[model samples]
Target chain A: MTNRWIVLMVLLPLLTGVLSTPIVARLRLSRVLGVVGLSATLIAGLLLLNNATSEQAGGILVSQMGGWAAPYGISLVFDTFSGLMLCAAAAVTLCGYVAALGTLDRTVERRYFHPLMHFMLAGVNLSFLTGDLFNLFVAFEIMLMASYGLLCLAGGEAQLRQAYKYVLLNLLASALFVIAAGLVYGMFGTLNLADLMRIVRETSEQGEALPTGFTAVSVVLLTVFGLKAAIFPLWFWLPDAYPTMPVPLLAVFGGVLTKVGVYVIARTFPPIFAAGEAAEVIVPILLTAAALTMVLGAIMAVAYRRLRAVLCMFVIVGVGFALAGVAVGGETGLAGAAFYMTQSMIVAALSFLVCGQIENRVGSDDIDDAGQFSWYRAAPWLAVVGFVLAMTLVGLPPLSGFYGKLWVVQAAFTGPDETPGHSVWWLGLAGLVAGTITLLAALRWWTGVFWLGREDQTEEPPATQPASTGPRSLTLAVALLLAASLWMGVAAEPVLALAKDAGTNLADPQRYITAVLQPETTEPSYASTHGTTTPANDQAHRASPSTPEHHAQDSTPPATHADDRFGPNHPIRLRGGH
Target chain B: MTAVLAICVAVTFAVSVYLLLGRELKAVAMGVFLISHAANLSILAMSGSPILPTPDPELGITKRPPISDYDFDGALRHGDIAAPLDVMVDPLPQALILTAIVIGFAVMGFVLTLLVATSRKVQTLDVDELATGEKRHDPVERPAADGTVQGGAA
Candidate 1:
């Protein structure tokens, strides 16, 4: 029953968005719907988390759509990692929505804002929960589409241009995604992730080589995900586009979209491609990319004068951490990556919210132009909250941020095939240095905005007048996020435990595959050879000269090969072999 | 087939670079579209050629075609007619290209709208001119006032 509501937790927001579109003209009702739907989703997410914790030993709890099992129907798995992401997404969207509600003009509110926000939340939720690769693509589109709407909601010239680029880049990514999905489907004859895992393993064991087809698919998938995740070469468009959205929308986008891409990459890598030498090559490249991303993002953050732009840079930093963590590719690395992602999301969102507050008070986000508002005197509580969140972002001790970094550093140093000597050590050191630079950058920005005293009188008054009183609701929303960040930082044990469990699940993907595949009363014959002999042989075969011919032969529909691969009463073997 | 994709990719890459360097916003957008198409084509090429139909042995064709008679895959396979398209074009890249095309269209549309809005609001399409940074406070501010304000020294 609780699991049932978990699915609804995501669906409710989307449903409300769709249902309320007709009545969007009624601003009050749209507001009501947005709050109610998101609030309910938040509660549902919390409830799901509690249920998951209580039943931690129960393994992964799966809710299959339409009551069909794996390979036949779509499955939504609720594990510790996904559950945590779901809760974080729900919390961020809820807080961002509440914050924007108080300050968003009624006209803007009525014009698709509420619906889009809800849809964005729904998309984020779906991205976290879906067990199908194609479904992940769909979730991405849902989120991107909503983001497009949200990005250009203000209809400013600059925003429109930026939004265009954002939309275009993402659309290209989606297209690549579909093609990748089709390729994967063609190779394995299955779109279900669990089924793919089984098939990949079996093919390798059957002494069948990996087809060039799979390699092409893997590269394309990586490129698409890289574009979305904002890896160094592909990240130029993000800083430009993200800062243009309204602060609240920016906060959510900053926190969620790219992380969704990271999650996909993380989820898919160890399970499907762990055995491939390609993963080995890819990891080093990813590490290099991570280093570039970190240095570039930090430098850009320092260069930017706009508060929102600086926060956007931090988003890149977070992505870099996730990339580095993933590139390390072990239990500890994955845990650290997961922990870092969660912490980064919280901190990034808080920073954006604070930036929004400053923007409201100063009537500008430009650091040089923004005069200190005596916010400590004017909005003391908000200032305190903002300061705490900033400290968390800087990874000061006792905060969630510090723990996340610690986990990643520990993973980097202690992981099983630890890279010897200075290379991994340097990478780890670079990460630490990046973290320190980010901290200093945040501190510098904070000092300028909060503690520098008002700018000299010679500076021109900002073109727009500041709002007399910061919106009460907005303040409360920031306070809520601040409190949550601090609380997560202070009482880090439980969440860290959950993160650890999530990381473990991610690292050891057999449980994930089993949870989804659900070896029932009728055991699958192919299941036995999946992780063992077949996958390795298949990988070798793929690398060998006869791959093209073998792939052509293997591409034959499963219906034709199933009987030969596994006799009757041996469904698992058949499933695994094909 | 590879040659065709290669040419397309090269041409598109050049055009994209040229357009990206251009000052006109429209050219930039069009450049992006072209580059994306080029990328799509490149992906298709990378997937290799599709499996060609097996030649009819009865049609006066030998069991093993001569070196000159076969396509790339056949040439590689040493005229083995039995090899079902060993290099059948990977459908994944094609699928990916298709997705890229659709996304390109959506992005293009959004960008077009933005271009039009920017031109109207800023009253100047030149990015350099717009960089003067005269803040336009209201959505409904008159175009003339904006022009005068930025055009004037103060």
Candidate 2:
């Protein structure tokens, strides 16, 4: 019963958003509808997570759309990993939406903001659930389209002028995505992730060399997702593009968007590509990029004078730490990555919301004017919240952020196994140094804003125009996020346990493939038919061209040499292409 | 035929990248438009040769030999006669191409509107000029009527 409603996790919000737009406009129920739709989706995701974690479901729940089975139809597979991601995305977005209710301009709120946000959430949910590679591409498009609108909705001339670079960079990534998907389809004869995993696993299991194109194709896919994730070489567009967004939207974007890319990388790397030869090439490059992203991002965060700019750089640093955990590659490392990502999302959202409240009080986000007003006198609780959040972001102990960093650093130093060469000590060192720099930067920003007492406080009027008792809704939103982060910190044991389960499931691809295919009941399966021996060896299969499976499907003659053009023999398989 | 299509895709992609790197907003918009087409074309190529214009007069579409039936087994496949189903005119890539085209069109429309509005406001279509204009027009840097800087940028 729960399995059947998995698709609704995406469809409900989509329908609510599309159908209620005009209705809500007249009745002024956009906010109500948005809240109802997202809360429902969040509940559904939580239920799905419960189902996925249960013993009977075996950590995965598969829902084939339109009664189609396995590779032939698009399936929505909900595993522990995706379920966790879905919950985090929904929770943060809900916070952002509620915050927007208190903060956004009336005009911007009235102008399709609810619908667009719901639409983006629907996309995010679909991306996490979809089991097919092409479906992932579609999901990315849906998300990106909504984001472009949101970026410019409440912004001014500065935003309009800078919007092109963001659009163009995403457009480039999308184009590359298409090219990569097309190539994968051409070579693999299927776009279903489970089927691709099966092919890679079986080919490697049979001890036959996979075509070299697999590495190139995987690298290309990484580059595409990497650009989305805002890692080192590809992250240049993010800091420039993000600072101009409305604070509420920034909270959501900062929390969710780049993490989607991280989620995809975590999902794909361990299960599908790692089983093959690609891991050897991918791991070093991934670690190197992760190291660079961490150090460079922290440096820039310190260098930037503006609050938004510094926050933007910290987002990159968070991405780097998550990626470093993933590059470490074993169950422990992936568990660390998953835990860190969830923590990062919550912390990022909380930090931005706190900053937004500060901006409201101070009249600007520039740090140079920090000493002119004492935040402690204006709103004591907000100042305290900001200080705590700053501590969390810098990875002070007993905070949610610290545990994630500890796990990643431990994994990087100790290697996932007893293997000596696998330990990423330098990456771990880079993470530590970056953490220290981040601390300095966070303390600098915090003290300047909260601790500094104005020398002529009695003489000059307060710069804060808004009453100290501003909208309660604003504080409610911030408190919600801050509470969630604190809960995560205090209750790290169970969360880390869940993350470990997700990692365990991901590290073993066979579990994912079997759960999706359900090979025992499904007709003889693709593996049974084509995977008798050296699966792609054309010469061996040529003698028995029309397998029984082909006959079973239809009275169809097998395409001569069609199998030869795929797998290891395809022309795209250039030696030493990397 | 595949080689020809590959070359066409490569050229389109290279040209789009060049346009994308240029300073003019119009050129960048053109690049965005061209890159989508290039992406669409590359995906289309995966479906098999997209019935391109051939230089050889004998191999023209009207004069080209019709797809014939050839079967090693006593079986006929669905669209199997069209040079085997998967190898020639795979519908999946066509479906992919169609989706890409529609998405590309929508994005291009939005981008054009944004660029046009930006260009009009800044009174320049060149990105470099727009950027300089932005610095000049920034409210944060602008001085008030009484000679005090706005936005508390001390």
Candidate 3:
């Protein structure tokens, strides 16, 4: 199949979401429609992944919009990394919706809840697909706007108060993002990622030094993404703003919102700017922040007596692991980061859904309310689910979380060199300490909520027993997510392979650049599918006089120079000449 | 000209940051708006001095400036391009700033509505009071008969 159709993954949700408001209030079939929309997006994502990893596509797919080729027009890039993230995010949101069907309050559901959810999903998918920096900013605004509405929907005064902080902080980040994009455009003269990569590559090849403000621009970009990802010092807005949302919304927020930040970081860094002093400055700072985020997140989780608070803190901890893995910046490290990121999204959302189930049963998420009660006697299935979730969060063996964390630590200790370095060992050490503390916290949580009164209450129903078993749909949703997590653990080869492909593609961006800039040359199949190019135009493009540098650098050819599209061949002037 | 723009952006940012740190919700909301404006201004400054096209007397038509010919140093090299860089102001930054402004406006509208609703429900616009959750506890604040605390204290 041609890859241009991958844009439908975004269009489907956007159309469905915009239409959901009328369908819900009038026909009352929004639930079914929401399920169908999300499932379709998931299938499209899976298909995109298959096409991206297939031999014909060469691990990357680029679709230019409005026939305005690269550097001048917007492009939608669907690489292995985007495909994997797209699939994970779609699956998590689908499950969250199903869970919400059983758990959402009727008033909220009537107040355009499903529409907002779908709108948020559309923004997320677009963020993953967009190849331009400005487009990413627009996507972020879409997502954040939907999130603001969702956070305050059906909220009392407290939730609205929290929403104020959430909106303002994100507004600040959005403003910073605009400034950063402008700076990048001023320096590089292009907002397209692949074009930026080409420029950065050519300048370094010509032995030209980057500008002095390069590091500052990099820091601003990092700060924008860091605030979104909730990295160390920028994470203060998360813990308070998140818990005020309804459970299903919180589940989606915990799942993909922060992951989007990590996604951009992994996509931008290493691939575009990993060659020089910028890497030297940014990598160490990233590692330090990762280590600090890990230790502090785990500590906060341990200190919180509430289940949702603990879950929220674990989301931060997962961010730390994923960031560390990305900062390591090699095939192994990036692959590990991608793997851990996908796993954490699923695991975190599932844990939140389970917490929602607990809350529905007991009317509160406070651990003290459980009060030395053993859920084993009251609700065996819930006890089992909660136990598995806690174990996964603590990164125990044979679970999905353990595999990803193991790879990250392995990448850290091995470092990029032949021998391990003393510098990055502290990151691994921090992960270990945090893991141990998480285990302690998980034990405390599990015993207090699920295993404490086992001996004394044997076969005796307690006075404060849980209400009637919650809806079957909620159980089904939890079970589906659990099965997905377990499947990832037991059969991790396919996912790991996809992640490795993504890492390989990221480590060497030439294929991506060519696929984007000159699709016909890189992937001939693309030309056959979309017959917009002519042989006469191709000749003129190659023989254009504006690219004298390509002819000058003939002695030592770069790898991408096999095709004349590589190097400092001006794309716009060439196209204009034709 | 660029230096003046730089100073203007700096001052705008300073004012926004100060307002952002204030205790009033309305001030914070305005701070967000000013910050967005400053960001837009910085982006507009990236275009440098704008040059309006003039009709050429000989050709009887205005010449369109060529697109950028910039290297990594952000310096223009006019060797390859047909027209000199001075005649063309890069339009991409203006496009970006436009998009940012529209999104900022939508966000500001939402922020205003949220602030109004929050202050009405909580009965105070003070950010510190909102954060304390004290408003939720005492939704109505009537001063004591002894007049120790003023009504609607800032």
Please tell me which predicted candidate would have the highest TM-score against the true structure: 3
Can you write out model 2's per-residue Cα lDDT over A1-578, one digit (the tens) per residue? 12767787899779878976786455357777777888888888888888778887788888877766666678788888888888899999998988888778787777788888988888988898888998999999999999998887864666766677788888888888888888777666577888777667656654567655878888988998999999999998787777778788989999999999999998887766655798888888899999999999999898887787788889999999999988887787788889999889988988877878777766677776655666656678877788889989988888889888888898889887738887889989999999999998898888777776575577554544666534676788788999989988888887888888887876777788777765233345444577743222322232222367533633444223332332332222211111
- The TM-scores that each candidate's chain B achieves against the reference are 0.63, 0.61, 0.63
Candidate 2, superposed: residue stretches over 4 Å from native: A519-578, B48-88, B134-154
- Can you tell me which runs of candidate 3 are displaced by over 4 Å? A273-275, A417-423, A454-466, A521-578, B48-86, B135-154
Candidate 3 lDDT over A210-323, as tens digits, reads 645777888888999999999998998787777767777788999999999989998888766445558778888889998889899999888887887788899999999989
Query: Could you arrange the candidates by lDDT from highest to lowest?
Result: 3, 2, 1
Better of 2 and 3 by TM-score: 3
Superposition error at A94 for model 1 (Å): 0.7
What lDDT score is found at residue A359 in candidate 2? Answer: 76
Candidate 3 positional error at A402, Å: 1.8
Best-to-worst order by DockQ is 2, 3, 1
DockQ of each: 0.12, 0.25, 0.25
Q: What TM value does model 1 have?
A: 0.77
lDDT of 1 by residue, A1-578 (tens): 22555688668888988978898898778778888888888888877778877754354667778765567567888888888888888888888888888877777777788888888888888988898887787788778878888887877656644554576567557656665775565445457887666656555556555545566677788888889889888997787777767777778889888888788888886667544545655666777888888877877778777777788888898898888878776777788788888877767887887877777777777675554566655556655665676677768898778887776766666552455542366567778888888888887777767677563544444457564445877777777887788888889888888888887887767677766665232333342647555432433332332356654655554433222332221213233222
Distance from true location, Cα of B87 in model 3, Å: 2.3
Give the DockQ-based CAPRI class for model 1. Answer: incorrect
Which model is ahead, 2 or 3, in terms of lDDT? 3
